[model samples]
Target: MTRNATSFPFDIVLFDLDGTLVDSNRDLAPAVNHALSLEDRPPVPEAEVRNLIGGGAFAMLERALQATGGPVAQTRFAELGAELLAHYRAHIADNTVPFEGVTAALDRLAQLGCKLAVCTNKAEEPARDLLAKLDLAGRFDAIYGGDTLGPGNAKPDPAMLYAAIADCGGGRAAMVGDSTYDVRAARNANIPAITFRYGYHDVPVEELGGDAMIDHWNELLPTLEGVLTS
Candidate 1:
């Protein structure tokens, strides 16, 4: 994509994977339930499973287990997490899809000369796989996942955002996500954050503390312009 004559305020725009770019609960909930079934736990309704997302696979599994019954032993938890990932990978895009207006919005950003990158808490391989399967991978300059920077470097930790900005040839940037991890990471990195109100946030969208909140993809560019310019 060619840059327009008028420069976009932010050089790079980083996005979160699960809830920000796509509504992945259809496949994610089932994967969580699949792991729960191993412990004979009842399935969490897909709607409820939406609330369990955002942190990462293991964190999602932990929330699912806690909601169904209680926590499991670490070893068992690891095993269940493996099961969840296995099931998810096999059916990754079975029902997963981007939110309304996502493609158009991305195209608009590209036209505006904004380099896009995904800064997600999902593992690097699956994050790439999901985007590639959806044909959205090529739009991004980079994809940084929870495992991308090694242990203890996921969002709410700023490292991934910093890395993504640098990898995309650093300049002023903003994070667009659906959860606290995204907002907090942007704050930690001293950048602006624009959050989606319809994402998988556990708390009220107002409580997310993003620089700006958007209810739909159509609002993204204007919101980003507002946030960056104001």
Candidate 2:
């Protein structure tokens, strides 16, 4: 594709679902706690759950388990993970919401001819379900989740990112996310990444090594433009 300096800088903008696009921990924490409760483990505080995000349900649950006690057996852990997913699916959007200005930013991006897509470590079914409930699914050309390409193909691997771009019909692309996995995937895919400071990150957002970082959705477009064009 030919570059058009005056137009939007990227043909597609890939986003991470949990932290980057929506504040999901409000709902996620409870689901995690639900699983922990099944194991007679103490509940993880919602505030602290934010740090446990990024690696997906299993990882988050593992972190929660580790914090509360210790790791469970593989069979038991899988069962708890299943329980967590069931609870999460039932109440996925109870308290989850797009961060302020997300709608407006997405609108502006679409108007600028950017094809939006999601490349998340979340499983595809629930990710789609969550976005559909939020009325945000229609805005994206594609939504490639962790399980989309089968097991062992989630972010930080770059497989899903590449798949999302191809499914979006491939073009100049950039990633917008809030975790090391996201940034690492973007790097592996040779795309610039813009990190959101307000999203869940285990490390300091600055240490994630994104091409740029923004504290709000209002800063997204301009920051992305700068990253992609300069």
Candidate 3:
């Protein structure tokens, strides 16, 4: 792989938004609790909500409902899910913010001319809205949500990752995310992956199967550089 001012081994960097870039638990936890309250169920703890994320809104709600013994029917979940999405959108950035050093790290990557994109389990519109709210939307060349490629092409399937690479001009790429969905998708795509330690991982970060694990945004560039050689 050649390394130069305008050339690098990887031309694109795909990121998973929720856990990898932003900590959305503050807003997500309350929204799910509110949705649960609508069904007269007890509120699930914030920590539990954090664990349920990375799969998308519906999956999060499903797990929350299951935890509270609420109805899990197709219709019932849809009805409550609508409420949850609405609540989330209404207060998307109430407490959501990019993790420490995220903006600076993104700036560094952009300066290096690496095309950046987001592949998240969140819905397209909400993802855009949230990123815009946080002033991070303009930084990405593309953003694909769980529903962006239909219901079956989300993370852990590699469809979205493939789409992201193609959409970003189809070059050498790497994935940066926080959970199994991210790592598994990277594996399916046959791309190197780096897991961030501060994100919302259901299990252990070491077990997520990333090519590398980074504890802070400052380490991302070096990790990506290493991936290029190895």
How high is each candidate's TM-score? 0.96, 0.96, 0.93
Q: Write the per-residue lDDT of candidate 1 for residues 94-119, one digit (tens) a residue.
A: 99999999999999988888889999
After superposition, candidate 3 runs with Cα above 4 Å error = 1-7
Q: lDDT for model 3, on a 0 to 1 scale?
A: 0.88
| lDDT (C-alpha, whole model) for all candidates | 0.91, 0.90, 0.88
Candidate 1, superposed: residue stretches over 4 Å from native: 1-5
- Name the runs in model 2 displaced over 4 angstroms: 2-6
Q: Which candidate achieves the best lDDT against the true structure?
A: 1
Candidate 2 residue-wise lDDT, 2-25, digit = tens:
332347778888999998899999
> Which candidate do you rate higher for TM-score, 2 or 3?
2
